[model samples]
Target: MKLSSPENQAETAVTSSLQAFLETDIAPKANRLDTDTIALQRALSQLNQFQFLGLRVPKVYGGLEASLLTFRQVQALIPRYSGAFAFLQTQHQSAASLLANSENQVLKERYLPAMAKGETLMGVGFSQLRRTHNPPLTAIPVEGGYQLAGKVPWITGYGYFQYFIIGATLPDGKALYGVVPLIPTPQPEGGNLEFSSPMQLSVMNATNTVAATVENWFLSEEEVLFIKPANAIHDSDKKNVLHHGFYALGCARAGLDILENNAGKKELPFLEESHQTLAQKHQSLSEAMFAALPPTETSFQYRLSLRVKAIHLAQRCAHAAVISSSGAANAQSHPAQRVYREALLFSVSGQTKAVMEASLNTIADYV
Candidate 1:
């Protein structure tokens, strides 16, 4: 319950508690929750009560400000039980990250404590790729503050969250961050927030993705948070490095766990060597990703460069795990199959394989 202290003992305690909860409460019912919204809600409510949702919020707002390393450890462990559940939990932490970075005190005070206590849920709308094919969607300014009128293709956790952080373009065409409430709307099918399922592919089937529209959605002066300075992609990239680092680490650890469990149960040649090599590669990549993200340090585009390398390493590890799993992994019911599928989700963390590849190529050109 102590906040702001980086203690190994606390982390160990949290890990043990979470593992016990997953085993007793989550594992037995994970299958049911995978496609059941109500079950997911019940589990998430448990997570909230345990303060898992507020693990990274600052102590002043009733959060523990848990160390990033501890956060990563928890994320890794959660996927061992269920990747779907783990991702839902991570979204809360991501919300905490947004709260931590925002410059608006009023917004922080109003939402952070409630979010920490799990009385409210938070979602972010920043994944827009403009229909016009702009660099990214921008927030244009309007009367008083700004009007956010764009489409974010994949806003996760749509119906469940009560608040959202939106990115928009100002009138001068400056990119800005804004916050809005997702409540008190007109009646819709018995008054619940309407949600549409995203087109499903492989991993994270139950994440509840939806396309969000904020058409001329106006924000008052109080709701506008920080407008990132131009040419701050370095800082942006650095932050994303940390975020995606944890994500990749979580998926890799899940994959490694599957690999370790299935090791020596087969007659595959060089199995030990394969496992060891993959483990080493994953570890090195994880370290590199962590090393690239220095807390509070801002630079232009360095984060993006590091992210490209880190994701490539993660893809390699995921591929290796699947190939090594071979005949045993072919079954969709197999844990290895699940891990393999989940691993592919890492490549789309920002949602465009083409852009990701292009960015990596651009970085490589300079290197």
Candidate 2:
């Protein structure tokens, strides 16, 4: 699809707005985190002002309602300035997508407008779906709603997001999806909700990821989104791997840009050749993956392969960036080092068992 087509004009406008925002508001403070954490209030406020927090929400709800390809393009723009900001924004986009596609009109009416207006922010707590056996959280049917118990391993944007879309497995093996307020009023009355301190990570430490323990927390029908059987969830999830690919590609592109800018005159030949090769690969894979949207099993596998390739390319480009920067790259504040760490995060992000096994098998064949 031609990105410059009239159909994509709206998307182009949003992208342009995002670029301006990144250059002005986010870039200067992108590397400077206060106490190793972002002050999300200011960041979120800026995102709201730009209407970026609702980039994917439907126009009916007062959002820009960008296309999926356009959304991916926007995703690729942010990590160049701040990986932590990009990561956090991606989760909000995911949550908005879920809400946009939900079957519950009441829920949508209640939250979608608020989300679009940036009055409400949402996080995701569905990483437990990655577990192949013995899921961390479970659901039990009660008179009014489902009772939730156990822990959610990771939920980012803790302080910023007021709500989260959490998934739990039912007794009949279907997946139960619901939204719960992160900070309940009056302290949940009886210790039903609790959260751990934010985790410290090697990279993206400013995102403020946290773990939550829910003990018999109740979610009524009003709060529940849509429930899906295991097969349906798997089918939906397999198509999402491409989003990760775009993020990795963004990091790789950032590194390549840094490397090219810093290359000495004598080193320009090698840097130019490497840059062209990686850029061509990135464009080809990105086009192929987007063309395979509404992914079938075969397409899903193909996209997974592309995801692996993107991660590998990002790592190589990040390393090349560091090498080009030489001793200067070793500093804690070096952009090359930050890009390198961000590249490492792609390997584990959005990982499922099938993806993990496929990546391992691919590496084994290469070795």
Best candidate, TM-score: 2
User: Runs in model 1 with CA error above 4 Å?
Assistant: 1-8, 19-34, 129-143, 182-197, 231-234, 267-269, 291-310, 324-328, 351-355, 358-367
Give me the overall lDDT of model 2.
0.79
Q: What TM-score does structure 2 among the candidates reach?
A: 0.91
RMSD of each: 5.1, 2.8
Considering every candidate listed, which one attains the maximal lDDT? 2
Q: Give per-residue CA lDDT, model 1, range 42-92, as digits (tens).
A: 888898656777887888898867777677667656865676787776776
The collision pairs in model 2 are none
